[model samples]
Target: MAKQYDVLIRLLMLGDSGVGKTSMLCKFTEEGFNSTHIPTIGIDFKMKTLMVDDKKIRIQIWDTAGQERYDTITKQYFRRAQGIMLVYDITSEISFRHISKWLDMIDEGAGSVARILVANKSDASALRIISKEEGQTFAREKNLAFVEGSAFSGDNLDEAFEGLVKIVMDRNKKDIDEQLQSIKLYGSRENSTIDAEVKPGGCCS
Candidate 1:
């Protein structure tokens, strides 16, 4: 732990095909998106290390195939994820409508994980079908981090990932506190038991 990063964050990407999940991921890890079209087959991931709040962190980002056929395979990765990005095309109503299905998979696979709603293809305003207000409303209802991004033009990709890590870090801290409290409680019980059998001189008199 001392030699490497202080924490590890596993972020999973999910959404319909052609929503640019792969492209968005590439933008974050590579600082550029591939212009050539190539759909993700089953699953893939990228690892990047960063220094946040003076702590070293390694973010493992996983991208899953959006096709229904690969749902079973992709769901397996949700088990240990700390953050989840639900991406959708800003220009496709069908893709936006199907966000619920992807969200359901997360619930079943990575329940209670930190969630963010990404309105991708913000650069394509002419082809846009989903309004920014509509997306923001949905995110507000669900209490999720909301951001508009464009992988091709390089927009808020960094903000989206940064927001996710902050959420995960807060949760991780809470979990650690709970565990420490439990250990203290158990130790106190053991000490009480020992005291009950001994006299006042710190001996079994």
Candidate 2:
């Protein structure tokens, strides 16, 4: 078979328990959401291969179990992640309040990793304890990419995932470009040294 993608990216969704992390995963990957609330027992994996700006990308999403007991395992996934979505329920004040702690976790595991601040369950506008303005303010304060999403309504899911992917891809491209440029410069320097080493007799150096 022909090559399917230019890159395979690992992304993780993290937050406190009952922030609807799994629901959002199902919403984005399966285009469906589960009404019944089931706490994730362990890490779950999903993959979607698609074209982004003419580049085929296979995004491997790691859905973390949000309970405190599973946090040890969840933190392990952070190290290898290219991007992370820090999610929280709009209706839950406590969930919103814990964003700083989650960010600290991200720093400890994936330092300076690409991240998005997601105010999830936006469909719960009526019950929203954390206002959209509040979320935006916090995102600005943290200088983080931000999106308000609703897994139930399939709202802003694309924007959130795509935004994070774009950030990661851009960073990857930049890093590769720098490395290639460095190699090119090194090759030029090596050739210059070789030319200099060739004396009148062109003897081996």
The digit string of per-residue lDDT tens for model 2 on 125-196 reads 889899899999999999998999898898999999989999898878976456446645553121121123
Off by over 4 Å in 2: 175-205
Clashing pairs in 2: none
Which candidate number would show the highest lDDT if scored against the true structure? Answer: 2
Cand. 2 TM to true fold: 0.84
Number of the predicted model whose TM-score against the real structure is largest: 2
Q: List RMSD in Å for every model shown.
A: 14.9, 14.7
Over 4 Å off, model 1: 174-205
Q: What lDDT does model 1 reach?
A: 0.78
Q: Count the backbone clashes (under 3 Å) in each candidate.
A: 0, 0
